[model samples]
Target: MLCALIGSACAGARDEGGTDEADGQGDEFGGSQECEPDPRGTEPEVALPSPHEQLYELELDTWGISNAGGDPVETRTRMNEALAWALDNGFEGVRIPAGTYRVGEKTSDIYTAGIELPGSMDLILDPGATLEMAPNDTWNYCVVAVRGLEDVRIAGGRIVGDRDEHSYGGADDEGHGVCVEGASKRVLIEDIELTKLTGDGVLIVGQSEAGSCEDITIRNSELHENRRQGVSIVGGIRVLIEGNEIHHIHGTAPQFGVDIESLSFTSKDIMIRDNSFHDNQAGDFVNTDGTNVWFQGNTLDQGDVTDQVDGPIVFWKRTDQTIRDNVVIMHSPTVNGLWGVIGYTNDDEPRANPVPNYIEDNVFEGGGIHLARNHGNAVIRANQIDGWMILGSRLSCLRLSDNAVNKAEGESYKFREVQGVASGNLLNGAPVALPMSDDAPFTNSPPHLW
Candidate 1:
């Protein structure tokens, strides 16, 4: 029980935060017994003693090595210094005792991290403590910046920014609560509240120097009231973004409650689930580039509007993905785009073709246009679609069959006499005549079925 050992010993700092590494036991994702070499043979050397073991050694040395007893604010400085000392002296685990710690210069009165932990370390924040950032220092934002490190975790605590200086990255300023560099991996950011970052809130960004960011998880958190996106995921592999409430993240820089975009390289195996996204203006809840992703069991609600953003979930240049069991509610397209899941071939030659994507068991209701425009091929089935049919008569060229189309707001079309079924549908206008309906499969008629 390495985590238990660290947890029990660091219990004294009820206010300050401490990192708990569960004793060499494996977690749901991967445990100690599952540690394996990279299939590519380029595995980064796995450190011995596990990070938890190293943390235990550091906690013992810190018992009376230093103290931040003068002012509660000094706790932040002490925490950073303690870890700095530990790292300098070859100690590994750094603990942060809790309490309200003020950041920035007292004369300036700007909120900031009382203690700053430099890049590269295993640091923990106690549940009761708070990390407040400076208001006037938008140029100097972000309470914690993890730059070029491996095996990092910031769990359980609150990181707040001054609402008055809410304009940190007002228009083009680049500020954040916590910005992780690309060279970092095995990162876990859990159970935290990040509020009012002028730029992007809790950004997991990749730098040019580092090829890509990988193996990240952001779970059980609340990201709200930021000038920009609540959470932005870029340039990563095997990313799990789940169980988060992202809302009221409005800003001038094309904001999205939760945006999954690619700046340079593509991200793979992205699983976004069990989350709630609502009230975002600039764009729909989820946006992304071509990648193997799974969007499941989530709720997306767009309030009253003329053009209620774009698609609740938009996929471009994507392939082999599954968009299932999602509840999309509001005033726009449940799905919009050539391919609900598009295939993109970048570069003149085009690398990967978009094909084999699944859009099933989704519910689209009220003022939403459910259409799939382009892509290689897609499967749209078992979806409860109701509202404006914005696409021209011809929505998709690849495939369409066994769908319950009812009370469509606009026109509908069939494959260019190419032969796809349109039988089991409740068409408000019966759609433009198709070349053939017998070639494809059609079942229960609209009113009777859906």
Candidate 2:
């Protein structure tokens, strides 16, 4: 992915070497296998490991968190106390040993679950420890809540949500495994296994006075088998999601591996790189309202497990994105595969965009790119596309150059509705005039992508 339309694009300072790969031995999503130092990105950006000093080993009997595992309300009360005990006692780090603690509480209309952390602390869960959210009827719940805090690190262990025992008769069902909300900054959630939620594996939402979380990193983690999304970034700045396997997102609409749809322009400088995305039901990713978003170096594979509904990647009318250096594999030309690798669209009428969306250096195994509508500028360069190169959309300017195109099917359409220039392209290894005029080019029609 290309590196947004706002302030400045921030990059993570890495150490060296690759992170530990998922063992992939038993289950689908694999384990919290303690990834090595520095996450592995296709572009090789490393995450600094959180330091641990003066770390206190918390005892379950002393903290009394596991004693009330059978009772939801009591567990929530004890869990909150256990998390705060260390911070209040002048400690910067605490470790929870092996135990299964069920937690949540309902008071009035608001329901709170999991352990909420304070600022400037490190919370480590032992290898066998599992913090499971209790069954509830509320529409919103979180297994771990990091709300409006700063300089927090949550690592190791597993955070499981209440998907199997959740009541589904209600309207809203947003039970996330982890929630990082408010204007929280300098947060790192790494090497954890979060799965089986009704909502998302992790939801990084901005609900504070600043309107966004800053400098957040979720890396070397496994987010799998979630109901809605693997990672939902409603608002975050300088966010990095790398070296993880986000898979098996199904049982709902817009079920993507990572969804970066912020309210207004709240999200910018977000990078989704070097991750393995496979068997995601709807698609791998979708950037609806993010600026300066880079979706690069990720491996997206829609195997025989499921049919993709929204293709591999889809973006709304944002011209400040870079989608590059990705290996997108489409199993077969299904409904969304005709125009598969990446798709762009807009619902309302034309609008002006200053920046240009760059789609470059991508290797599309059996897919291509598609632009539907709206007046935005785009640059499509140096891609190996085996499917449609349909660019009939209304745009401000389009630069199509140095791309190799080979058709999956025999038929190809003409492009009579473009407003840019195409040059140095190869159609089946032959120099073909781009933006092929009505009878010369290949283009997708209006709206309604099947």
Question: Please, what is the TM-score per model?
Answer: 0.68, 0.82
- lDDT tens per residue, model 2, 7-40: 0111110011111122111122211122111211
Alpha-carbon deviation at 365 in model 1, angstroms: 1.7
lDDT at 140 for candidate 2? 82
Superposed model 2: Cα runs more than 4 Å off: 1-52, 67-70, 333-337, 342-344, 408-414, 435-450
Off by over 4 Å in 1: 1-78, 87-92, 104-122, 137-140, 166-173, 303-308, 317-320, 331-352, 367-375, 390-397, 408-450
Pairs that clash in candidate 2: 1-295, 1-296, 1-324, 2-322, 4-292, 413-442, 414-441
lDDT of 1 by residue, 126-198 (tens): 7775666655543445667777777777766777766554443324334577776665677777788877776
Q: Give the CA lDDT, 0 to 100, for residue 83 in model 2.
A: 64
Report the error of model 2 at residue 174, Å.
Answer: 1.5
Residue 179, candidate 2: alpha-carbon lDDT: 90
